[model samples]
Target: MKKNILYLSLAVIIGLLGGYLLFSINADSTNEDLTDNHNHLETTENQMWTCSMHPQIMQPEPGDCPICGMDLIPAETSAEGLAFNEIKMTENAMALANIQTTIVGSVEASDEDGIISLSGKIAENEENNAVQASYFDGRIEKLNVNYEGQKVNKGQLLATIYAPSLVAAQQELITAASLKESQPALYKAVRNKLKNWKLSDKQIDAIEASGSVRDNFPVYATVSGTVTEVIAKEGDYVKQGQPILSVSNLNSVWAEFDAYEKQISQFNKGQKIKVTTNAYPNKEFDAVISFIDPVLNNNTRTVTIRTTLNNKENLFKPGMFVTGKIEGAIHTTENSLSIPASAVLWTGERSLVYIKTNPNEAVFEMREVTLGVRNGDNFTITSGLKNGDEIVTRGTFTVDAAAQLQGKKSMMNKSGGKTMTGHEGHLGIQESNTENKPNSDLFMEMNLPVAFQIAFQAALEPYFKMVDAFVASDANQVLALAKTTLEKMKAIEESHLNKMENSHLSKSIEILDAISSNSDLKNQRDQLVVLNENIVALAMNIKTPSETLYVQKCPMANSNKGAIWLSTEKEIKNPYYGDDMLTCGSVIEEIN
Candidate 1:
């Protein structure tokens, strides 16, 4: 019995040892699996995060975009992703943004010359202008040319003057003729005196034959032209060498274009010009540059470039507005790349464009380009681009806005926010703080009348309403408010104000009228920029105590040149950007 018990104990001990060893091995394997799983979770949590709009921003954890204040998304960890400057867009995002691209190619060179556009007025050619004057002292007479603009011919009877001096001379001639047989020299002297008085030899001969003196002598036109001015009436007595009328030959006319100081260098005498007029839209008149005025108008800072155009068809009338174009050398270098003006975004002196870096993908990168000259709808590129490159031509502004949001290289942010310290000194805010503050003594200096002040204040109400509409991004409301503003402005009579005030009011009305006609929000906003400038001028020149106004500026507005608008409150609600960038501006001034 003792031996059987010992065997059972040994078997039990062996089985327990095997079970303990297997459990220990399984525990070590389980711990290893748990460690591997924890590492995988850590890797997922530490993935890089980036903003969809600002691709340049990268972070170790998911968060929001600092620039645009948008939600952050996971950045691509694959090696096949785009480079630092390049931005990738999905097909849906591109369609939503309406982004379009164009494949660049070499444009065929042509012999056509570039055009230099000019604005001017049709004026009378002073060289062809003539003045009709009386040759002898006269009494009341019959005038043939009744009104201004009357056509006259050379030697045509213009007037008949009843001159006592002429009658006396003729009587003397008759007396001299009677004594001719005895004194021939005296007869010849009288005849010569009559000839000097503009009397024809035939008239002198007739007077001698009839032995009578004429009561009146006829005056004839010295040149053929249209009557420009009738200086003296027929009933009024005139002295010898006194101007009666001014005539201008309409066969030729002068086109006087106002050339800015910068454009004066492009003008030269004998250059061919093609002129078009509003009166005859289909017809184009050819002319040659006759002269460029040596003196520049100090106030206007412009010189007059005169071109003589043939007016044989009588189509070009005086005082008509015209546009002249001169063929000249192109401002751009040969074989340079040219892109549409819309494709460029200007930031002060910097000009930038978006180039498609990848043909197979929607990848774009911002590039700074050197601008040469601006053609009508195109701009000549002097550097920073090459042929056969693809670029964004349409919706470029939208693309730039996206780039700015993504913290990429843009017109406003060149370093792509890599060194961005904070938003404490934003461009719009900084400019508003220092530059455009209203003067406290501005109203005190203006000696405006009370009645005129009331009228000006009333005109600002509709303008305020329009500002609210733009803030809300309601285009329909903007249109309605613009019309109401225009009506109020037109109702303000200019006669109530003094000369300077009237001038300011008239300009404001004209700009408001233009704004009222445009239904497009962008166009209306552009005009609003000018309208606000005029309002500021008016406010500075005239006191309006009944209302308080605020002048705001958006450095990003008007293609980044910056634009100003009038507001009722100190807070900025940018009219230029509407909701796209609602808080993109700041209050610059306070007016009362």
Candidate 2:
């Protein structure tokens, strides 16, 4: 009975030990799970937050972006393995931006010639220009052509003149006609004298047949043409051989193009040129270089190139802008590689292009390219691009924008940094760095007459008034202000300005004149954008004594291309957006 009790005690002790070991294992597992949960919570708290619109902004805590006022989101933890100069974009974004690429290839031999592009205007052919002059000292009794651009036909009656001399001559002719048997030479002299006055032989014969003197003589058109100028008016006394009117024959016109010194070498007399005009975009007019001016215009540093066009249809009008392309075997070679100009982006002195590195994926890398001569719509790639390389032809600006947003190498930023925030990071918000500003040198060397300074500053007042009108969204007021500004600009003595300064002022006035003609606020604003550039250039060259000028920039203007205007005050008043965004600009520079 003692041996049976010992066996039961051993069994009970072994079962108790097994139960304790199982409980310890379960407690240790519960502690380990709790430790893992604490670690995951710590990691979630440490994730970096950043703004989506401004990817350059990063913070440890969630907040709004200081630059664009956008809420911050958690940054992606995975690193995007991209090169410093490379930018990756989704296919959908690329399509939405209208990005297009072209594969560079060898140009055909027939199309390898370099073309020279020139800007010019249609003008009257000097050879076809005619002047109508008075044949005798007389008073114009009646004028038929009232205004410029009136068309007159050959042998058409143009005017009536009352000439006492012609009446006396006619009386002498009658007397001579009676004495023709006795004084035939006198009679012939009288007739020849009337002929000298441009009287038709038929009219002279009719006068002699009636044996009566006519009070007034009729003037006829010698050539058929459009009257370009009316030199004389009715009741105005004119001397013999005095110009009465000027006419230009529209049967032929001259397409006069300006060629710079560098481009003049590519042109030769009789070279064939293809001309295009905005008025008739599809039609190409073929012409030959008739003449090239031997003298260069010092101010423009260009020479006029003339090409005659048969304008029998009168399709081309004077003052119409034209683009001429001269294709010749000038600077073209079989080994030359040319790309569309759209593929190139210009940032100061650097010319950059986006190179497609991957065919399957939408990957683009910024490349610095050396440019040669531009031929029509294409630019010759001197280096950095190969014949078989793929390049971004269209939407290059869009690509650069994306690169800028992603902190990749871009046109403005060669070595990309984290995206910038705040007012300094906004596009077109330029801070004045007086020490490094390009125009700083110009300011140091500038010297202007006191009169010029006062006049130029006064001119800005009208422009500012116009800006106020625009801010009010008053189209009529803008129009009226534009006219007043134009008159003020025109009244300025341009002779006081040097050649360069005068040229800038003239361009400004031309733009303002364009603004005056358009009552549409948008059109006026568009013109103002260009006018602002001219005024800024003018202000930079001339001294503004005792006056402070503010150079304001609007990034949202000109279809988002951005523009700058000169203002007298530090306050922002945007003319481009008018009342909708009257204060959508920042002061970029201050000129004193």
Candidate 3:
């Protein structure tokens, strides 16, 4: 019995030991599984990301950005405190947003200048012009100047006239001369009277020596000039003081121009003007403004600007059509930043621009800029901006739309102003593909193909978002999203009635871009709202213009009834209409 108990105890101990061994193995496997799972999580947390332009993308996990791609940079978020409206992105996001920037140096303060371009016709200077008239009633016996453009010297004989009174006067002089020695005083008085009648001393001497009555006398030129107008032909009777010819001095002529009321501010007495005439296309005449009309033409709404030009060669003639530019002082208000007028987006009240922020980021920020003056092609920024602030010299509209889609500020906000929400990620909205955009049919009732309509609809998707954002005054968001959508639509393959497809969409995209800049959107809000309404209405009304196709009206584009459609034969410069402009609405047309 003792032996049996010992064997049983040993067996129990072995069984328990075996169970313990099995349990240890299971624990090790469980630990290994847990460790593997933790390793996997760590790997996921350590994924890296980066931007296309900036390859310095690094991240602890798999996400959009490291530095500027998706606003994922911890430094960016920490640099500017996080806010609800603030959106941080990764480098990829930035690339997607097409956020572009450039480095800028400090700009020196300079005066603002404006240049006004105008067209005018060359005119004769009245002050330098003169007329030749008859001293007494007579008939022209001969003509010294047979045609126009004949030069005559001062006091030179121009024509001869015969009159009964003149004959009687000559007879009296002759009779007095016959008794010269008997009545010397009377003869001298008669001679003096002849002199008073404009008879030259030499002529009087010749008549006294001849001792005879002259039936006709020669008339002389009052001034030297070219005969511009001939009032009397040979043998034509003329009354006393009647004009025979109008003469204008060719040595010096008038460079006269008309300045409109709006351009009056540009007209100054002594402003240097470079004048050109059709007669001499290759030659240029220099002159300074000598006279400015105080009164405007009641019918033409223009003020006359006059200057004297040296036409000694007689190259310039009266009534010659001419064009000139009066380079004058640039008008400006005090304390302002002047940039190329092309840089400003005139939305109405405020001006907006896409300011270059960083070249590395290829990013620009939409800024509202207060304007003071417009000189020539430059504009003065009164407020909301500073010198050395780099702006998009070109393609600003495209950049602004990208900013809006990423929840950034844009110029087209319905609200008046915006506060910086901090650095957000780039959303690299699709670039505007204007290549295939066709002209709009806003005023036409023509039908388009189904495929074309579909393409158009696709293009409009982003526009709707853009308009919505604009109406809500979500400047940044609207710009960013709208830009992307428009860009994408522009890129899509389109159906076209003509070579261009969805051209009106491109115009709408441009409008959205202007809004995105946020410079002058407050003033332009009313106009923009009207544009938005029209776009929406048009989109809603998009249908087949004819039985076989679909169509929609782009109010900002297309021709209307009784309006000559010259687009087919010539280039159309109409600013109010086109494919890209379709979404701009009827405001352009209405105001125009």
Candidate 4:
């Protein structure tokens, strides 16, 4: 037994020594590997942090983002070898943002030949218009061409009229025909009177041969054209010489253009112009200015210019929008550079553009351009730009956003955000050059298009009803109203919104969908905090001031974070707290 125990102990001792040696070897290898790569690894103390939503918030340590109240992530190193005025963007970002660039050209060398553009809509040519009038006083018994846009041919039966006077006249014609041998002069006079009623000689002879007095007479179309209006309906009495139908020769149309007072000098009667419409973007219709209004419109500061277009194929509609381009005076290359109007951003009194700094890479910088004159869809840069310099012609706003995220100057004015009272958590994205005073008209400078404003106004009406539902704390009603409001929002026209505002609108839709699915009041209100950010941003910039909207804020809502909702009334009806704090909110801003 002692010999067996000694052998086991020796085996155990050998296993322990082998394990120790392997551990020591691993420890030494790990130490060498780490020490060798220590220089390459980034230190935790030196790491920077930034927000995913608001990339401008950069901090030295890991914490929640000050702007969004979200956890920060390690910041990516910026592109090196860039000038102070330049900002570098990745190729992926450029493609995703749809950043497009175009080389600036001289106004004289442009394909448009520095054309002066005029905005107007297609109108019916009045020169070839004719009115179908009744030759005799009668009541319309039947109408063949009843509605507008009906085609009518010359000599086609338009309507049948019932006339007692015509019946008496027809009786006289038969009597006069019977007594023609006795009173030849009287018979001729009676025949002449019947001829005066626009009756053909055959029709009068047939009536006399049948020896009958017809009460109904047929009226034929005097002109071949489209019926524009039906003045006299069936079973209605029409006086002699009264218009029964309006006929317009639609083989031609008028391309009426509105020229601003500044462009009036460039236009004259008999000037040749190129007219185009969205329907036929690839085609240009040549026309001559037929007329120019002698007086300028005081309300619009514009004058009317008329051109006639051949529309034999029915290509031009009356309400179709059209543009008239007239060749404008061209300047030398040294005089000015022409760039697309989409590339320019107007901020306060400054016109800004983004220049593609690198020819081979995606690097951009902001430029304050001196705008000279706007010609057609292009603008003339007097001094700020030079020929062959590439600029952002499309997605200029997206480039501006990228520049903003990179801590670079952008088209957005260095002006501060709205510094409203009562905790503006969502609106606290401070600009780099705010000078410590926030401009209350934060979104006023956004330059929302009239089309977007009109659509948003239509959608916004239903949102107030949804707010009222929230104020009543009726979750089911809120859900129904959310659906209704969302339905309205789906119809909103987003083509006119800028890139940033479009993004805001998209996010608002997502939050609203979440709010619609949930029944909990707290959850819905929580989502409202984010949704209101987008809505208020749009509201502050609406160019169409139709009504007085009170922007009421409740600081205690959104879990101590403030939230706002627009109201048509001055009274505060708290949507967040309902009856518990119905009047807890205060008016922060009023959108007129």
Q: What does candidate 1's lDDT look like per residue over 341-416, in tens digits?
A: 6677654346788999989887789988987654445667778889978999865755664565445776556788
TM-score of 4: 0.53
Per-model TM values vs. the true structure: 0.47, 0.55, 0.40, 0.53
After superposition on all C-alphas, the RMSD of every candidate to the true structure, in Å, is 14.4, 12.8, 16.5, 17.7
**Candidate No. with top TM-score:** 2
Candidate 2, residues 4-68, lDDT tens digits: the string is: 89998988888898888998898889888888888777766755566564444445567775445
Query: Model 3, which residues run further than 4 Å from truth?
Result: 1-114, 278-284, 332-592
Give the poorly placed runs of model 2, Cα more than 4 Å off: 1-121, 147-149, 171-191, 205-213, 231-237, 257-265, 273-287, 295-304, 313-331, 345-370, 383-392, 396-592
Q: Which ten residues in a row have the lowest lDDT in candidate 2?
A: 427-436
Tell me the spans in candidate 4 whose CA falls farther than 4 Å from its real position: 1-70, 74-95, 100-122, 168-197, 200-209, 231-233, 236-242, 258-260, 274-286, 295-304, 311-333, 346-376, 383-391, 399-415, 418-592
Cα deviation of 360, candidate 3, in Å = 28
Judging by lDDT against the true structure, name the best candidate.
Answer: 2
Q: Give the RMSD in angstroms, all C-alphas superposed, for model 2.
A: 12.8
Ranking by TM-score: 2, 4, 1, 3
**Which whole-number lDDT from 0 to 100 does residue 202 have in model 3?**
95
Clashes per candidate (backbone, < 3 Å): 2, 2, 74, 0
Residues 1-592 of candidate 4 have per-residue lDDT tens digits of 9999999999999999999999999999999889866844545554556656545444556776544467877766545567776766655445544578999876665476656777778988999899998889989999888999999999999999998889888888887887899999989998888888788889988998899788889999888999999898999999889999999998999998776565666777888899999888998999899999999865345678999999899999887879888875434355567788778766424678899988998878898898765676777788788888899987665566555544567543353222221122233223211112112323435767787788788878878888998888766577677777787777777887765566567656755665666544555665565566667777888866689887777876644435677789899999988866899978877887
Q: CA lDDT of each candidate?
A: 0.71, 0.74, 0.55, 0.73
Task: Report the alpha-carbon TM-score of model 2 versus the true structure.
Answer: 0.55
Better of 3 and 4 by lDDT: 4
lDDT by residue for model 3 over 1-592, one digit each (tens)?
9999999999999999999999999999999999999987765554433334333232333455412334433323211332322223445544433444432233243431344444555667677789898888888999888788777889888999887777777778888988999999998998888777788889888887887778788989988877888888898999888999899877777766666456677677888887887667788777888989888765345678888888777777766767676654455445456676546666534567777555334445667777654444455566777655777654454454434444456655533232211122222122321112212223323345666556556656565455445444443455466557656655655445432123334445556555544322232342343234224323433463222222222232211211111111122232233222333322122100
**Global Cα lDDT for candidate 1:** 0.71
